[model samples]
Target: MLRAAFLASTLVFSVVPVTAPPPVDSAVDCDYYCDDRDPSLPLSARRSPHRPGTSTPPAPAAVVCNRYCDARDPALAPSNRLAQTVVVAGRQVSLRFDDTDAMGWGAIAGAVQPGDEVWLDRSFDAGVSWGAGSRLGDTAVPPGFGDWRTMMFNVDDWAGLGVGLLRACGRPAGSSTIACTSWYRTTWNAWDRRTAAATALMQRYNLSTGLFDTTGWWNSANALNAVIDNIRLTGMTGYRYAIARTYDLNRSAWQGDFINDYNDDVAWWGLTWLAAYDLTGDSRYLATAKAGADHIFRFWDSVCGGGIWWSSSKNYKNAIANSLYVQLNAALHNRILGDTVYLQRALAGWTWFLNSRMINSSGLVNDGLTSTCANNNRTPWSYNQGVPLAALVELHRATGDPSLLTKARALADASTTSAFLNPGGILFDDGGGGDVPSFKGIYVRGLAALNRALPDRPYTSYLRRQADTAHARDRSSADSYDQPWAGPFQRSDAARQHSAVDLMNAAG
Candidate 1:
């Protein structure tokens, strides 16, 4: 059971009655608003914010309609709808929120277009919402310095982003070689990493069983799952997928030679596989998730006066990892149907995070330990704060713990207002020197996840607005992928195209 924090004992593991979706009424149907009262509007239209007008404004630049447009919009339609189809490895996936809910893929429906106007900000909120298509008018950066790369090589994290975009958008109902190839290659890369790391860890550490070879370190099962799924999707053979078990303390390089259950890698991989099982109904993925869950359970002792250790190392007890542990366990308990033991583990881990790591009054979650254990204690990052909010919400759903909900809401409030997010809710990474996208991406992801978990009218609307603002700024930048310091902003048509896809995906 979750240890009582600020909430009184009355709010034990009892479940709260979820507020039903509001009845649909004749309101300004934000292209994607949800109202149970009126299910007549398309779910996507309901979730969408009310656009200023139905007709899209003219594109700032002209892009070739290409094969995707030829296939999807027969007339080579230059409408915003055609722009909604983002290219992936020379293929484009159309964005239509006809079936999905606000929680699923509503954020990015607007940005994926026939042309690259809107850009997707992956970190801020998955691709449910969009960023700017390309800078609006003169605000747009011209192609130069960063322009050559954009022109010469359209290379981006194209494959991964494509798969993610496709998954969120409707998977191509038909098999497009372009979509398949992009999906295949991306999954292959992820698989390669996971396999290499897992193999190396098991061999080096002789990790036969238990939570991990050492408790203080991290785990890689979840990472492995992400990789494996990619591999399966792409159908790549002999990919030499490598996964590592630990990070070298001196070199700071992730060592792939041994298994350690301390890291929350298991949770991520297991969850991924669990998702795969749901999507594909594969028994192997389910089995793998179960094994990983069992390993996680081994470490769930009443340690450090609360949750499990960050890793096997007694010195490494930290909040970020433990909070992840809470989320992992809770996901398994709530989403996946195995390992009931994780329920108690999730409860305890959440309680410790709330009582110890969470910043009282501020509702911010902190990283328990860092380079300097004493001073670095409780210094929070978006990921640290964000993941816990997600966990708290999930736990609240599973256990009806009002405190968890309150804490999650509080954390969400703090994150939206913190330095991590620009005033408009674009997530920015702090202490990253200034790798804006990567930094903000994680933050945005956390917010997006929270938005999905907690479906309130006010909160959902805010998420939509924030999603729009981030995309607009992102499109204004010279290079979508490169940070300001990434060797002078390089702009490419591919980059612009990607930006549009990213933005539309985020809006969904």
Candidate 2:
């Protein structure tokens, strides 16, 4: 998503055609050339104007070829290219490709100086190694230059047998540090991207602790839920170990069975465990969910006329805590057999929630109730809008009430179309470095649940838009996503990743 406005005037140069290297032996040269038709051979070997070993060396000509081109090929048109840039060492390093010509190169700009080096890496594998063509088109900025680029090289194999991956790498003038952009594969479809995103999410998992590193406790539950959903949706079982790992390691944390003072936190874990039970049929996960649900219902009181308190202190009644309470109880009722008690509690909770006036005129749920038990009218956080949709969906399933789905649809329609909540059709929430980072994903998860229950799947385009934006713009070169789904990826952590992964799961 990095725009062309950032690119400096491109430099063009011609290089002397050298003798072609010996044909690579795939069997013995597998370390450098993994396949028989490696694309790493110098341009002279493929289509140089002066054929190799010619007695009369033809004059060096501006490199020009289609499908297979030398570095800095004049035929590489700028208009037919796809590019993505990342900030590295305080400079812009971009990987650019002209798919029409099956050519790619690297660029560096911003405070450019002599010794600032940029290059392109080609990999027959998925970036596991650079293979033979790595460092292709490597170039450095000259003195007083504002930017520089490497020569063009073919992105496809020699015979168009396969499309390899490419990335832009750079190093500052005086820094030993080297950084590279994420690998770009031209053939990757939506499912391939989702798989990559899920793989990146799992990389943050702490196998020993059964928690995703760089995120909080409750956020880990959401992360686990996203992982489970990814597994179910994609049928990829590689990360299934996380299910038992999280349950076994964290089941005893904080007063046993994921029970904590914050009712919402406990509810997140409860729902996550329920999802695990559904995925793996683990009775322990279901039992833990039941335990957490029972514990959360204990916090519901006459206070605020009947909604769960945010914490054990019972100082405030909030929309999130209560909404989660409704969702957990309703979901438990639907899952458990002979569950009159859970059903009644869910219905009672729903009745009180409807009368609570937390849902505003715009159909978005507000943050919480005021001290006077009226609507607090706090900023309508995305999660506040989300959990309730899930609650309504579960309630509808338990009671077969058509009205529940109607209410869910209204909330879904509002949130999906809201100017602030979903600007330009992509979900937006700054997350302010706290629990906010996890909020948008929860909303999308709810929207997806409601979408599944509806016959029409009205939110299909909406979900796909969010996922596509995140994949194209919000992701870092490492495939990690930050909060904003639009662009300019700032940073990434477990919370941000799970939120994006949830979107991927929904859309996939």
Candidate 3:
């Protein structure tokens, strides 16, 4: 289905047989040294290039969440969301999403405690990885310039009411709430933009019957992510309109004649509902995620020697669909205890994807396998690389196998290089038009998940460079973020903005 520019036929997707892994020290020098032979040594210890006695260094300053926001763009104004309060330990902490003057993450902005550190162990990843509490308000910027609380506020406000929602530009804070230009419409933010845009795309373009639109499912999933992310951060309420918009209520399944027939699109929404269930403690969302997982596994066959098909037509097997399969299983495994089936599915899918020759010699993941089961030689999309990176990391956590972690680290390291990034670490892949722009955000999200898992790794610093560059160079005075992070602002859309938001949050 993907008609990218470089699609080419290759020999049957030849199996890269699993020979005994070359000795850990001499495995062609991937991201870090591939050392999994020893079980007890921490991954950092195993990959250490320094002397045996060298101390494990502190995390780089650039990577971890510092201050929430600052005068980095003196232009940023306070646009707080519907304020909400939550009980932390026992005391209630009032939090806002868009406070230009907020102090810490959840506590009332400006509420700083001596030696205070935020404990970040979130389900942002399918599994729970703790960051061991980093210093709150840890940026080099001047005090009060920014705080952890308002970090995502400015971005979401701009995307929703600032630009995408209210279509207001250069207006002062709170102007978004009022009808300024004789035209008034309901406004949305990160809390609701994905659902709005995706539904619009679906209504505007879906030819398929019953379903909102095949393409809308992607943003539908994104909207679901936005809602989950909002509740996770600001302690506000959750919105399920995105789910209602894309979901087929009559059939009660995401993929059907009324919705996505493509397995991956269906899987995307299923994963979203899973995140919602994880956050909202709703069994309905979990049930939807499980059904989606079952549907994804149904597509898995021995046809290409075991990988999920891209569509029900069963003509092609792709990296995107398969990688998503891995991710869904990984997340399900994280949510479900005493269930080895999800882990089993994750292991099989990952194993097939890894050896399927789609990942070429440079460690870049190719697009899909041709009808003959050969590497299709399609231009590597960002999602292909990103989804599997987190999936593999999740798998490593599930099995306690360092080999999976080593491979995930390799993917993370290689992704930051020319395979995906341009100079200054701005992520660059295909052009910004069409769906290509959305792909990078998925990759960046994967990077964030990996960062949460390995807080001390350099991945966080590199991703920070991406977020900072995006804020500094990608956007224009109009507040619309452009393509190529550092280049031409041509063709900005929900995709680019969403990726930008993901990157900044990752930095935090």
Highest TM-score: which candidate? 2
Q: Tens digits of per-residue lDDT for model 1 on 60-120?
A: 1121121221012212222211113334433233322211111111112222322222121
Per-residue lDDT tens digits of candidate 2, residues 1-508? Answer: 0111111111211111222224322121123211122134333222111112223212112233445556656344553454577776578887777655657778898877799989876654223344455567778898877878887776545332232457777888777566666666442222376666766676566545677655667788899999899888888776788899778877776668988667888899999999999999988989999999889888888977888887776777888888888899999998999899888888888899889999999988888888899998888999999999999999999999999999889988988889989777678874464367889899999999999999999999999988888877777544667878886676566778899889888887
Q: Which parts of model 2 are misplaced by more than 4 Å?
A: 1-191
RMSD of candidates 1 onward, in order = 21.7, 17.2, 21.5
Candidate 2 worst ten-residue window by lDDT: 1-10
Candidate number that wins on lDDT, 1 or 3: 3
Error of 3 at 484 (Å): 2.2
**Candidate 3, 1-508: lDDT as tens digits:** 1010100111111111212223222111222212122233344323221112223223112223324432233235345443334322222233333333321133222433322222111111001111222122222222444222313211221111111111110111222211111001122322333333222222122112222221133543553464455446545342333444434442343324222446776677777777767775878777777877887777888987999987666667889889989988888888888989999999899989888999877788888898888898887777787888878877877888878877888887777786345555577775433355557778877877887777577687777787677656655322335558775544344445556555555665
Angstrom error of the Cα, residue 363, model 3: value is 0.9
State the C-alpha lDDT per candidate: 0.36, 0.73, 0.50
Cα lDDT for residue 93, candidate 2: 84
Report the CA-based lDDT of candidate 2 relative to the real structure.
0.73
What order do you get sorting by TM-score, best first? 2, 3, 1
